[model samples]
Target: MHEMLGNQYFLIRNYFEAEKEFEVGLLSDPDNFKIKKKLIVCYIQTGHVDSALTLFHNIVSTDPKIITDTNPEEDNCPCPEIIYELESILNNSEVELKTLSLAMLWLYCDLEESIWYFEQYYQFNKSTHIIKSILASLNKEINK
Candidate 1:
């Protein structure tokens, strides 16, 4: 089934394929926690942090330990390399970089760093409320 195929691709670090497979599997088994976990990593790895975080919030609502469940060694979820690749460019003062970096850091569960980037982003683009909303929601989760 798609879940098995997704797991195989996940283990191989082919996150794009894994994401596709997991998404399909999820369409059939929407409550599959394992698939959701792997898909979250795949989403963040593939620069789909919005999707990842959406699913993350969904799961974390019921399974409060999902963050701890996503360890690379224990769960085979790799650290999203895009975050590293993006780090090298953070010195640039581009709004998109700040937004992308914010999303990446947030997905990595680096809330402190994500907040830092969010601050940087807010300075450049204060008009958008979506990013603020995301940070607020994350703050609520952490505060609770």
Candidate 2:
């Protein structure tokens, strides 16, 4: 019910309303990846990049497979508008590198762009060995 309403609101570009509905749905089914992905799109559309990035990190940390798994039959890309918005955010000087890296990864940005973002993030915050491994793995995956 909430998911349907959220989808309707999303279709109409009422992202705030969609966010509310998706949030409600998430509370009930916290493990629903589809709902979580929808909510991330809503957050991105509504200019809540920080929130979206946080949720993105959570989702990736819980199930790294989500980053690698792709379903050819489904349109799994984030909405084009949201992708544009995230690109704008990434181009800005003040955005957080970690957030930018995760956003680019989630949006399935070009491999070069993803590598750049990840490199920038690593240069800024070198303490996270996990990010380095993830970057290495992403490079290996993309090369294949």
Candidate 3:
């Protein structure tokens, strides 16, 4: 119930309110991966990148323990299905989702996909120099 409301608020662009709901959901079910992921997204949407990054790092770090034969660090990025879901959200009016997706791609040095998402984000929200600079750097790297 709380999770659903929180996610609804997030989709409606009410990040602060969504954060509260997600925080409550987290308190109730600390190990719910879906809730955790949505909380991370809410953090990112609200410009709480440190929190989001911490969560991302933790998820990646812990995956190896759950899947014995898998080397989480070697993967170098979140699962492709996660990426596709995020990218699909980005294709919607979720500009913050696009930003986070691009940031993840950039963090992974996924130059090609980063450039694609960044271009789409830039087209929608042209106010940020940070994203533009990232796009420029990625473009330069791709060209090189």
Candidate 4:
């Protein structure tokens, strides 16, 4: 099964291979939360922040508490590196990346910051149902 092979790749830090396998695995079992979670990890490990956020929004829309790999000790976590990278380019006219970086920053740096970013994003894109759902989930998470 793709998930089995993907697990091996994930364990070895072959995130690209793991990502491919997980993507395939999802095609057959779209609701397999485990695969989607791992795929989110793979997306981040591969520097596909947009992809990771898209998938993350999908999962978090239903359960906001599932923000994955916020721990610095987690294997190959690039969140800190990403945050660091953002400092140099945070104001480089890449609106999406800046907002996405904020989303990521809260995972590894400050949870409240993510809420602020999500709130700002919502103000500009109120029609985005996914952002609304994510914002609600973030509120739910903070309230708990």
TM-score of each: 0.66, 0.65, 0.47, 0.69
> Model 4, which residues run further than 4 Å from truth?
4-16, 41-51, 68-70
Which of candidates 1 and 4 is the stronger one according to TM-score?
4
Q: lDDT of each prediction vs. the true structure?
A: 0.68, 0.65, 0.60, 0.73
lDDT of 3 by residue, 1-144 (tens): 888898788666577898899889888888766666656656765768667756654543454122222232453223344556666676577576556555543434354655676677677679966556655655655676
lDDT of 1 by residue, 64-131 (tens): 34554345546554654556656667567654744644453454546566566666666776886665
Ranking by lDDT: 4, 1, 2, 3
- Judged by lDDT against the true structure, how good is candidate 4? 0.73
Best by lDDT: 4
Write the residue-wise lDDT of candidate 4 on 76-109 in tens digits.
4445566676666766786765776467555545
Name the lDDT value of residue 99 in candidate 2: 53
Better of 1 and 2 by TM-score: 1
* Candidate 2 TM-score versus the reference: 0.65
Task: Name the weakest run of 10 consecutive residues (lDDT summed) in model 4.
Answer: 68-77
lDDT of 2 at 45: 65
Clashes of each: 0, 0, 0, 0
> Could you tell me which residue pairs clash in candidate 2?
none
All models, RMSD in angstroms: 3.6, 4.0, 9.8, 3.4
In candidate 3, stretches whose alpha carbon ends up further than 4 angstroms from where it belongs are 64-101, 105-144
